[model samples]
Target: MTPFFASAASFVDPLDEVSAQMHDVTSKPLRDIVVAGERLVAVGDNGLIIYSDDHGQTWLQAAVPVSTDLNAVFFSDPLKGWAVGHGAAILHSTDGGKSWVRQLDGRTLEALFVDYFEHRSGLDTERAQSYLSALLSMTRPGPGQFFMGVWFDKAGTNGYAVGPFGLILGTQDGGKTWQPGNTSIDNDDLLHLTGVRQIEGALYITGERGRVWHLDQSSKRFVMGEVGYDGTLFGITGRDSTLLAYGLRGHVFRSIDAGRSWASVSNDFAAGITAGTAVDGSGLVLVSQAAQVAISRDEGTTFELLDVPRPTLYTGVVSMTGGQLAMVGLNGVTTLQIQ
Candidate 1:
């Protein structure tokens, strides 16, 4: 049964109250969207969660417990799913996205980080100061908690959630418990982490100032890799050995040798590429903040433009049934078929 859930807004601290009912909720601000088997789920501002089982022809709101802005969402399958956003909120849904329960929130996450880092600092005095510094600034108890990206494995056993200030959390037992990454990340500057994704079996994090970090399997530590740009990279997507990292001011870089070396791929028209995905294995679709769409037929080698019916700031996108796409942005959900 679909509970009479609120629209996107109606709360005290956003975490203090459940969403309330509102009309035309699908037109509210949305940030991210993903495809879960036949259903398409989209989340955005004011804790909005809407899903469509019929290729986005219609929408239905989920019973969400909090009203905080949801930043990213992922589903390991059609049933088990997760969404992370502001206030250190991580939500899980057992039966698709019909209903959700809070897994982690600001109330409990602060102390968990303190305990983990304090213990870690005691074991390694050389990095103790670093850990302590991070403990105070990164894990401070308060209402401001933002997790920008999240992803889980196919079996829904292991997952990672990333956020601002170099914060990363991992869960092994299906999100029963989550822990701070064990090893110190190479981001000494503690740049804000924008996204967490897997590329060719390697876990990578994209962040500020064109910084990209990949976990070293042997050391289990994240280390920096250059993608030949110095602007904030919003995200990355690729197929096989070809990778594309895009960001501010219409800049995009491609790494053909598995990130060993990168060359310029940016063009004059592209501007602030925000969300991207690989479709049909070979085709790539990328959308920018300028409401522009670029399609790459041959991996990330080159791109061509596509027209949008109405231009708006596009934040996230996912391929839809047939040759269409379901995208979420400032004005809400917009579905367009590839032409």
Candidate 2:
């Protein structure tokens, strides 16, 4: 039996060692950040998983159950949570990220290929060869190939995942069983998906290219919703009565009337706003890809850079209990005690 808790040093690495440790660019920036009670979890390339019990002040690496790159994590409770990434890998932690078990190996794609070859669906040799080659290529290796965005439903029993090649998977029975869904969007990468919040009795998923899809609450069928812009929509966050969707190169869209209409806020950042998070009734914190952290208290109007000793890429920020701020990102995780 292995242990759940490990030292922070195991996950923390220097700039150069990061690439080799993760078998790729370690400094690619930790993308997904979520808080489960006092526990903070962040996932990134090559199965990197880190958790902090005392806010984001100190982080310890968890025994990753898989070697695939994980992109996003969502927790409905402190103990029950799910993480998703490349190769369709999905991990669940019943003990609040202290320990994680690979629920979905993300290798199912590979197994599907093996079965396809073994059964030999009776196709021409050339066509079969082409199919096999494409499958292999899809599973080859790298970021963006396998899985991307992962979200848990409000009930947390089910969640959706998306990635390259229009991949979409849904899980029921609390990550025990996942069902594949048809993402009518063709030839485009669905970077991220946001779950629905009750606003006028509708739920919507906002993804790449400002693509917004609505799920019928009663039927649970995804119907194409209105799309505002065509760009690499990166992150989506909802607060109060409005929804905020952002994308690459600073494209920000805001909607107060659900997904019906939107207004452009700003697509500009102070050079490296790789990821951001909006705190309810507070402000937004944008973390630069270059390890710079900035805070905008004026409702995404302006930003003030924070001073930190060890230059670290601030991936995302969230408000914690006792008015503290938690920041997570590449190679470094730190928390500011709100004075």
Model number with the top lDDT: 1
Shift of residue 335 alpha carbon in model 1, Å: 1.5
**Model 2 over residues 64-157: C-alpha lDDT tens digits?**
7665667678787777888876656778888888677776654455554545544543666676566556545653422324666666755778
* Best candidate (score: TM-score): 1
- Cα lDDT for residue 255, candidate 2: 71
TM per candidate? 0.91, 0.71
RMSDs, each prediction?
5.1, 8.4
Candidate 2 contains a number of clashing pairs equal to 6
Report lDDT (Cα) of residue 178, candidate 1.
Answer: 85
Q: Give the Cα-based TM-score of candidate 1 against the true structure.
A: 0.91
